[model samples]
Target chain A: MTQPLPMPVTLLGYGAATLTTLSFFPQAIKTVRSGDTRGISLRMYLLFTLGITAWGIYGLLTGDGPLIVANALTLVPALVVLERKVQSLRRGDDRLW
Target chain B: MTQPLPMPVTLLGYGAATLTTLSFFPQAIKTVRSGDTRGISLRMYLLFTLGITAWGIYGLLTGDGPLIVANALTLVPALVVLERKVQSLRRGDDRLW
Candidate 1:
Protein backbone atom coordinates (compact mmCIF):
# COMPACT_ATOMS: atom_id res chain seq x y z
CA MET A 1 0.00 0.00 0.00
CA THR A 2 2.95 2.30 0.41
CA GLN A 3 3.86 2.26 -3.28
CA PRO A 4 1.81 3.45 -6.21
CA LEU A 5 0.75 0.95 -8.86
CA PRO A 6 2.71 0.89 -12.11
CA MET A 7 1.41 3.36 -14.67
CA PRO A 8 0.12 0.84 -17.16
CA VAL A 9 -1.54 -1.20 -14.50
CA THR A 10 -3.11 1.85 -12.98
CA LEU A 11 -4.38 2.96 -16.34
CA LEU A 12 -5.74 -0.47 -17.11
CA GLY A 13 -7.48 -0.75 -13.79
CA TYR A 14 -8.97 2.69 -14.02
CA GLY A 15 -10.06 2.24 -17.61
CA ALA A 16 -11.63 -1.08 -16.80
CA ALA A 17 -13.36 0.31 -13.78
CA THR A 18 -14.69 3.30 -15.62
CA LEU A 19 -16.09 1.23 -18.44
CA THR A 20 -17.69 -1.31 -16.16
CA THR A 21 -19.00 1.28 -13.79
CA LEU A 22 -20.52 3.44 -16.47
CA SER A 23 -21.97 0.42 -18.18
CA PHE A 24 -24.99 0.76 -15.92
CA PHE A 25 -25.61 4.33 -16.92
CA PRO A 26 -27.89 3.95 -19.89
CA GLN A 27 -30.37 1.93 -17.91
CA ALA A 28 -30.21 4.18 -14.90
CA ILE A 29 -30.68 7.26 -17.01
CA LYS A 30 -33.59 5.69 -18.81
CA THR A 31 -35.18 4.67 -15.56
CA VAL A 32 -34.80 8.11 -14.04
CA ARG A 33 -36.00 9.98 -17.08
CA SER A 34 -38.91 7.71 -17.90
CA GLY A 35 -40.02 6.05 -14.68
CA ASP A 36 -40.45 2.68 -16.36
CA THR A 37 -39.89 -0.59 -14.51
CA ARG A 38 -41.25 -3.18 -16.85
CA GLY A 39 -38.41 -5.57 -17.55
CA ILE A 40 -36.14 -4.87 -14.62
CA SER A 41 -36.20 -7.30 -11.73
CA LEU A 42 -36.14 -6.12 -8.13
CA ARG A 43 -34.43 -9.26 -6.79
CA MET A 44 -31.68 -8.97 -9.36
CA TYR A 45 -30.72 -5.44 -8.31
CA LEU A 46 -30.99 -6.22 -4.59
CA LEU A 47 -28.39 -8.92 -5.11
CA PHE A 48 -26.40 -6.59 -7.37
CA THR A 49 -25.95 -3.75 -4.86
CA LEU A 50 -25.08 -6.21 -2.14
CA GLY A 51 -22.57 -7.85 -4.44
CA ILE A 52 -21.07 -4.48 -5.33
CA THR A 53 -20.74 -3.69 -1.63
CA ALA A 54 -18.91 -6.95 -1.05
CA TRP A 55 -16.58 -6.19 -3.91
CA GLY A 56 -15.87 -2.75 -2.51
CA ILE A 57 -15.05 -4.33 0.82
CA TYR A 58 -12.72 -6.79 -0.83
CA GLY A 59 -11.07 -3.95 -2.71
CA LEU A 60 -10.51 -2.12 0.57
CA LEU A 61 -9.01 -5.21 2.15
CA THR A 62 -6.77 -5.80 -0.86
CA GLY A 63 -5.76 -2.21 -1.51
CA ASP A 64 -7.21 -2.21 -4.99
CA GLY A 65 -8.14 1.36 -5.71
CA PRO A 66 -9.77 0.78 -9.06
CA LEU A 67 -11.93 -1.96 -7.67
CA ILE A 68 -13.22 0.31 -4.95
CA VAL A 69 -13.74 3.25 -7.26
CA ALA A 70 -15.44 1.23 -9.95
CA ASN A 71 -17.82 -0.44 -7.57
CA ALA A 72 -18.64 2.85 -5.97
CA LEU A 73 -19.57 4.44 -9.30
CA THR A 74 -21.44 1.37 -10.50
CA LEU A 75 -23.36 1.11 -7.25
CA VAL A 76 -24.88 4.55 -7.55
CA PRO A 77 -26.70 3.93 -10.82
CA ALA A 78 -27.64 0.42 -9.78
CA LEU A 79 -29.16 1.70 -6.57
CA VAL A 80 -31.17 4.20 -8.56
CA VAL A 81 -32.72 1.36 -10.48
CA LEU A 82 -33.19 -0.56 -7.26
CA GLU A 83 -34.94 2.32 -5.58
CA ARG A 84 -37.35 2.69 -8.50
CA LYS A 85 -38.06 -1.00 -8.47
CA VAL A 86 -38.73 -0.89 -4.77
CA GLN A 87 -41.17 1.96 -5.30
CA SER A 88 -42.98 0.21 -8.15
CA LEU A 89 -43.13 -3.09 -6.34
CA ARG A 90 -44.46 -1.45 -3.24
CA ARG A 91 -47.27 0.00 -5.26
CA GLY A 92 -48.12 -3.46 -6.68
CA ASP A 93 -47.29 -2.05 -10.09
CA ASP A 94 -44.48 -4.56 -10.58
CA ARG A 95 -43.99 -6.26 -13.90
CA LEU A 96 -43.62 -10.03 -13.84
CA TRP A 97 -41.45 -10.60 -16.84
CA MET B 1 2.58 -13.90 -9.19
CA THR B 2 4.33 -16.88 -7.66
CA GLN B 3 2.92 -16.74 -4.15
CA PRO B 4 -0.74 -17.39 -3.38
CA LEU B 5 -2.87 -14.69 -1.80
CA PRO B 6 -3.30 -14.87 1.97
CA MET B 7 -6.14 -17.19 2.99
CA PRO B 8 -8.46 -14.58 4.48
CA VAL B 9 -7.96 -12.27 1.56
CA THR B 10 -8.53 -15.10 -0.84
CA LEU B 11 -11.72 -16.02 0.98
CA LEU B 12 -12.93 -12.46 0.92
CA GLY B 13 -12.09 -12.10 -2.75
CA TYR B 14 -13.88 -15.28 -3.68
CA GLY B 15 -16.91 -14.46 -1.58
CA ALA B 16 -17.18 -11.08 -3.25
CA ALA B 17 -16.75 -12.64 -6.65
CA THR B 18 -19.43 -15.21 -6.06
CA LEU B 19 -22.05 -12.76 -4.85
CA THR B 20 -21.51 -10.17 -7.56
CA THR B 21 -21.27 -12.79 -10.26
CA LEU B 22 -24.60 -14.38 -9.42
CA SER B 23 -26.46 -11.11 -9.14
CA PHE B 24 -27.61 -11.22 -12.75
CA PHE B 25 -29.36 -14.56 -12.43
CA PRO B 26 -32.94 -13.54 -11.86
CA GLN B 27 -33.20 -11.31 -14.92
CA ALA B 28 -31.30 -13.68 -17.13
CA ILE B 29 -33.51 -16.55 -16.04
CA LYS B 30 -36.61 -14.56 -16.71
CA THR B 31 -35.34 -13.49 -20.11
CA VAL B 32 -34.55 -17.06 -21.09
CA ARG B 33 -37.80 -18.58 -19.92
CA SER B 34 -40.27 -15.88 -20.74
CA GLY B 35 -38.45 -14.01 -23.50
CA ASP B 36 -39.51 -10.78 -21.89
CA THR B 37 -36.86 -8.19 -22.37
CA ARG B 38 -39.19 -5.27 -22.05
CA GLY B 39 -37.20 -3.52 -19.40
CA ILE B 40 -33.73 -4.51 -20.57
CA SER B 41 -31.63 -2.20 -22.73
CA LEU B 42 -29.46 -3.36 -25.62
CA ARG B 43 -26.99 -0.49 -25.41
CA MET B 44 -26.78 -0.99 -21.66
CA TYR B 45 -25.86 -4.67 -21.97
CA LEU B 46 -23.50 -4.17 -24.89
CA LEU B 47 -21.60 -1.76 -22.72
CA PHE B 48 -21.89 -4.10 -19.79
CA THR B 49 -20.36 -7.09 -21.55
CA LEU B 50 -17.58 -4.95 -22.93
CA GLY B 51 -16.96 -3.59 -19.46
CA ILE B 52 -16.85 -7.09 -18.07
CA THR B 53 -14.43 -8.13 -20.76
CA ALA B 54 -12.26 -5.22 -19.82
CA TRP B 55 -12.38 -6.28 -16.19
CA GLY B 56 -11.44 -9.82 -17.11
CA ILE B 57 -8.51 -8.53 -19.10
CA TYR B 58 -7.47 -6.43 -16.16
CA GLY B 59 -7.67 -9.50 -13.92
CA LEU B 60 -5.57 -11.47 -16.33
CA LEU B 61 -2.95 -8.77 -16.43
CA THR B 62 -2.95 -8.53 -12.65
CA GLY B 63 -2.93 -12.30 -12.07
CA ASP B 64 -6.06 -12.05 -9.99
CA GLY B 65 -7.91 -15.35 -10.02
CA PRO B 66 -10.98 -14.16 -8.17
CA LEU B 67 -11.35 -11.24 -10.53
CA ILE B 68 -11.21 -13.47 -13.55
CA VAL B 69 -13.61 -16.02 -12.10
CA ALA B 70 -16.07 -13.42 -10.90
CA ASN B 71 -16.25 -11.59 -14.21
CA ALA B 72 -16.55 -14.87 -16.05
CA LEU B 73 -19.59 -15.84 -14.00
CA THR B 74 -21.15 -12.42 -14.26
CA LEU B 75 -20.70 -12.31 -18.01
CA VAL B 76 -22.83 -15.35 -18.76
CA PRO B 77 -26.14 -14.06 -17.46
CA ALA B 78 -25.44 -10.59 -18.75
CA LEU B 79 -24.89 -11.93 -22.23
CA VAL B 80 -28.17 -13.81 -22.06
CA VAL B 81 -30.01 -10.62 -21.32
CA LEU B 82 -28.06 -8.89 -24.05
CA GLU B 83 -29.00 -11.56 -26.53
CA ARG B 84 -32.66 -11.16 -25.74
CA LYS B 85 -32.40 -7.43 -26.00
CA VAL B 86 -30.77 -7.77 -29.36
CA GLN B 87 -33.56 -10.01 -30.50
CA SER B 88 -36.28 -7.75 -29.27
CA LEU B 89 -34.64 -4.70 -30.69
CA ARG B 90 -34.13 -6.43 -34.01
CA ARG B 91 -37.78 -7.32 -34.15
CA GLY B 92 -38.70 -3.74 -33.39
CA ASP B 93 -40.48 -5.13 -30.34
CA ASP B 94 -38.44 -2.95 -28.05
CA ARG B 95 -40.00 -1.18 -25.13
CA LEU B 96 -39.30 2.48 -24.78
CA TRP B 97 -39.61 3.49 -21.15
Candidate 2:
Protein backbone atom coordinates (compact mmCIF):
# COMPACT_ATOMS: atom_id res chain seq x y z
CA MET A 1 0.00 0.00 0.00
CA THR A 2 1.69 3.17 -1.15
CA GLN A 3 0.50 6.57 -0.14
CA PRO A 4 1.13 8.69 -3.22
CA LEU A 5 0.33 11.93 -1.43
CA PRO A 6 0.62 13.21 2.08
CA MET A 7 -2.47 12.96 4.28
CA PRO A 8 -3.27 16.64 4.08
CA VAL A 9 -2.64 16.72 0.35
CA THR A 10 -4.88 13.75 -0.13
CA LEU A 11 -7.63 15.45 1.81
CA LEU A 12 -7.30 18.54 -0.33
CA GLY A 13 -7.38 16.41 -3.45
CA TYR A 14 -10.60 14.77 -2.30
CA GLY A 15 -12.16 18.10 -1.50
CA ALA A 16 -11.25 19.44 -4.92
CA ALA A 17 -12.54 16.31 -6.57
CA THR A 18 -15.81 16.45 -4.69
CA LEU A 19 -16.34 20.08 -5.55
CA THR A 20 -15.74 19.63 -9.27
CA THR A 21 -17.78 16.48 -9.58
CA LEU A 22 -20.72 17.78 -7.58
CA SER A 23 -20.77 21.06 -9.48
CA PHE A 24 -22.20 19.33 -12.53
CA PHE A 25 -25.44 18.45 -10.77
CA PRO A 26 -27.18 21.78 -11.12
CA GLN A 27 -26.59 21.99 -14.86
CA ALA A 28 -27.64 18.43 -15.35
CA ILE A 29 -30.79 18.81 -13.31
CA LYS A 30 -31.66 22.07 -15.00
CA THR A 31 -31.19 20.59 -18.42
CA VAL A 32 -33.12 17.46 -17.64
CA ARG A 33 -35.99 19.27 -15.99
CA SER A 34 -36.33 22.17 -18.37
CA GLY A 35 -35.00 20.59 -21.54
CA ASP A 36 -33.37 23.88 -22.34
CA THR A 37 -29.93 24.27 -23.79
CA ARG A 38 -30.16 27.54 -25.60
CA GLY A 39 -27.57 29.28 -23.50
CA ILE A 40 -25.41 26.20 -23.48
CA SER A 41 -22.74 25.89 -26.15
CA LEU A 42 -22.77 22.72 -28.20
CA ARG A 43 -19.04 22.87 -28.80
CA MET A 44 -18.37 23.30 -25.13
CA TYR A 45 -20.21 20.15 -24.03
CA LEU A 46 -18.75 18.19 -26.93
CA LEU A 47 -15.23 19.07 -25.93
CA PHE A 48 -15.84 18.86 -22.20
CA THR A 49 -17.29 15.36 -22.35
CA LEU A 50 -14.37 14.15 -24.42
CA GLY A 51 -11.92 15.82 -22.07
CA ILE A 52 -13.57 14.19 -19.09
CA THR A 53 -13.35 10.81 -20.77
CA ALA A 54 -9.65 11.36 -21.32
CA TRP A 55 -9.25 12.33 -17.71
CA GLY A 56 -10.97 9.11 -16.69
CA ILE A 57 -8.58 7.14 -18.86
CA TYR A 58 -5.66 8.96 -17.34
CA GLY A 59 -6.97 8.05 -13.92
CA LEU A 60 -7.26 4.42 -14.89
CA LEU A 61 -3.72 4.31 -16.20
CA THR A 62 -2.38 6.00 -13.10
CA GLY A 63 -4.53 3.96 -10.67
CA ASP A 64 -5.72 7.12 -8.95
CA GLY A 65 -8.88 6.31 -7.03
CA PRO A 66 -10.10 9.84 -6.49
CA LEU A 67 -9.49 10.86 -10.10
CA ILE A 68 -11.21 7.77 -11.35
CA VAL A 69 -14.21 8.27 -9.12
CA ALA A 70 -14.51 11.96 -9.70
CA ASN A 71 -14.26 11.82 -13.48
CA ALA A 72 -16.61 8.85 -13.67
CA LEU A 73 -19.27 10.53 -11.59
CA THR A 74 -18.92 13.76 -13.48
CA LEU A 75 -19.25 11.97 -16.82
CA VAL A 76 -22.82 10.79 -16.22
CA PRO A 77 -24.62 14.12 -15.85
CA ALA A 78 -22.31 15.66 -18.38
CA LEU A 79 -23.51 13.12 -20.89
CA VAL A 80 -27.08 13.84 -19.88
CA VAL A 81 -26.59 17.53 -20.49
CA LEU A 82 -24.81 16.83 -23.76
CA GLU A 83 -27.60 14.58 -24.91
CA ARG A 84 -30.18 17.21 -24.05
CA LYS A 85 -28.18 19.89 -25.80
CA VAL A 86 -28.15 17.81 -28.96
CA GLN A 87 -31.85 17.16 -28.70
CA SER A 88 -32.56 20.85 -28.17
CA LEU A 89 -30.47 21.74 -31.19
CA ARG A 90 -32.17 19.11 -33.30
CA ARG A 91 -35.68 20.26 -32.49
CA GLY A 92 -34.82 23.79 -33.67
CA ASP A 93 -36.60 25.20 -30.67
CA ASP A 94 -35.06 28.36 -29.26
CA ARG A 95 -37.14 28.69 -26.10
CA LEU A 96 -38.33 25.99 -23.72
CA TRP A 97 -41.04 23.84 -25.17
CA MET B 1 14.67 17.64 -9.62
CA THR B 2 11.93 15.04 -9.34
CA GLN B 3 10.20 13.41 -12.25
CA PRO B 4 6.86 12.36 -10.78
CA LEU B 5 5.59 10.54 -13.86
CA PRO B 6 7.16 8.60 -16.72
CA MET B 7 7.48 10.28 -20.10
CA PRO B 8 4.46 8.52 -21.59
CA VAL B 9 2.37 9.18 -18.51
CA THR B 10 3.47 12.77 -18.47
CA LEU B 11 2.41 13.15 -22.07
CA LEU B 12 -1.01 11.74 -21.27
CA GLY B 13 -1.32 14.07 -18.30
CA TYR B 14 -0.52 17.03 -20.48
CA GLY B 15 -3.02 15.88 -23.04
CA ALA B 16 -5.69 15.53 -20.40
CA ALA B 17 -4.88 18.92 -18.98
CA THR B 18 -4.97 20.54 -22.39
CA LEU B 19 -8.34 19.02 -23.16
CA THR B 20 -10.11 19.95 -19.95
CA THR B 21 -8.73 23.45 -20.01
CA LEU B 22 -9.42 24.07 -23.68
CA SER B 23 -12.97 22.81 -23.23
CA PHE B 24 -13.94 26.03 -21.50
CA PHE B 25 -13.22 28.22 -24.51
CA PRO B 26 -16.37 27.39 -26.43
CA GLN B 27 -18.68 28.11 -23.51
CA ALA B 28 -16.92 31.31 -22.70
CA ILE B 29 -16.90 32.46 -26.29
CA LYS B 30 -20.58 31.62 -26.72
CA THR B 31 -21.58 33.44 -23.58
CA VAL B 32 -19.51 36.49 -24.36
CA ARG B 33 -20.57 36.71 -27.96
CA SER B 34 -24.22 35.88 -27.53
CA GLY B 35 -24.73 37.35 -24.09
CA ASP B 36 -27.21 34.57 -23.41
CA THR B 37 -27.40 32.44 -20.32
CA ARG B 38 -31.01 31.40 -20.14
CA GLY B 39 -30.16 27.75 -20.36
CA ILE B 40 -27.03 28.04 -18.31
CA SER B 41 -27.38 27.26 -14.63
CA LEU B 42 -26.07 29.94 -12.31
CA ARG B 43 -25.43 27.52 -9.45
CA MET B 44 -23.38 25.30 -11.71
CA TYR B 45 -21.02 28.05 -12.81
CA LEU B 46 -20.74 29.42 -9.30
CA LEU B 47 -19.66 26.11 -7.87
CA PHE B 48 -17.48 25.22 -10.85
CA THR B 49 -15.56 28.47 -10.66
CA LEU B 50 -14.92 27.97 -6.98
CA GLY B 51 -13.83 24.39 -7.60
CA ILE B 52 -11.44 25.41 -10.34
CA THR B 53 -9.93 28.03 -8.08
CA ALA B 54 -9.45 25.39 -5.41
CA TRP B 55 -7.87 23.06 -7.93
CA GLY B 56 -5.45 25.80 -8.97
CA ILE B 57 -4.42 26.39 -5.39
CA TYR B 58 -4.04 22.67 -4.86
CA GLY B 59 -1.75 22.52 -7.88
CA LEU B 60 0.31 25.35 -6.50
CA LEU B 61 0.68 23.62 -3.15
CA THR B 62 1.51 20.33 -4.77
CA GLY B 63 4.08 21.89 -7.09
CA ASP B 64 2.40 20.39 -10.11
CA GLY B 65 3.24 22.52 -13.10
CA PRO B 66 0.76 21.07 -15.52
CA LEU B 67 -2.06 21.22 -12.99
CA ILE B 68 -1.22 24.78 -12.10
CA VAL B 69 -1.05 25.92 -15.71
CA ALA B 70 -4.19 24.08 -16.73
CA ASN B 71 -6.27 25.35 -13.85
CA ALA B 72 -5.00 28.90 -14.20
CA LEU B 73 -5.86 29.01 -17.89
CA THR B 74 -9.21 27.35 -17.25
CA LEU B 75 -10.06 29.85 -14.56
CA VAL B 76 -10.05 32.80 -16.96
CA PRO B 77 -12.77 31.70 -19.36
CA ALA B 78 -14.69 30.07 -16.54
CA LEU B 79 -14.80 33.37 -14.69
CA VAL B 80 -15.89 35.13 -17.84
CA VAL B 81 -18.79 32.76 -18.28
CA LEU B 82 -19.67 32.93 -14.60
CA GLU B 83 -19.73 36.70 -14.59
CA ARG B 84 -22.00 36.73 -17.60
CA LYS B 85 -24.32 34.21 -16.01
CA VAL B 86 -24.64 36.40 -12.95
CA GLN B 87 -25.31 39.45 -15.04
CA SER B 88 -27.91 37.66 -17.08
CA LEU B 89 -29.72 36.54 -13.98
CA ARG B 90 -29.64 39.98 -12.48
CA ARG B 91 -31.15 41.59 -15.57
CA GLY B 92 -34.07 39.10 -15.39
CA ASP B 93 -34.05 38.70 -19.14
CA ASP B 94 -34.72 35.35 -20.78
CA ARG B 95 -33.93 35.96 -24.41
CA LEU B 96 -30.82 37.29 -26.02
CA TRP B 97 -31.28 41.02 -26.48
Query: Which one is best on TM-score?
Result: 2
Task: Kindly report which residue stretches of model 2 are placed more than 4 angstroms away from their true locations once superposed.
Answer: A1-6, A94-97, B1-8, B94-97
lDDT of 1 by residue, B56-89 (tens): 9888877778778888888999988998888887
Model 2 lDDT per residue over A61-87, tens place: 888777788889999989999999888
Residue pairs whose backbone atoms clash in candidate 2: none
Report fnat for all candidates as fractions from 0 to 1.
0.66, 0.64
Please write out the lDDT profile of model 1 over residues A4-93, one tens digit for every residue. Answer: 667887687677777778889988888777676867877788888988888898888778787788888889999999999888878888
Task: Give the distance in Å from residue B35's predicted Cα in candidate 2 to where it truly belongs.
Answer: 1.1
Colliding pairs, model 1:
A39-B39
Say which docking band candidate 2 falls in.
medium
TM-score of each: 0.83, 0.88
Classified by CAPRI criteria, candidate 1 counts as: medium
Per residue, candidate 2 scores C-alpha lDDT tens digits across B1-97 of 2437678876776777788889889889888888978878878888888888888888887887877888899889989988887787678765332
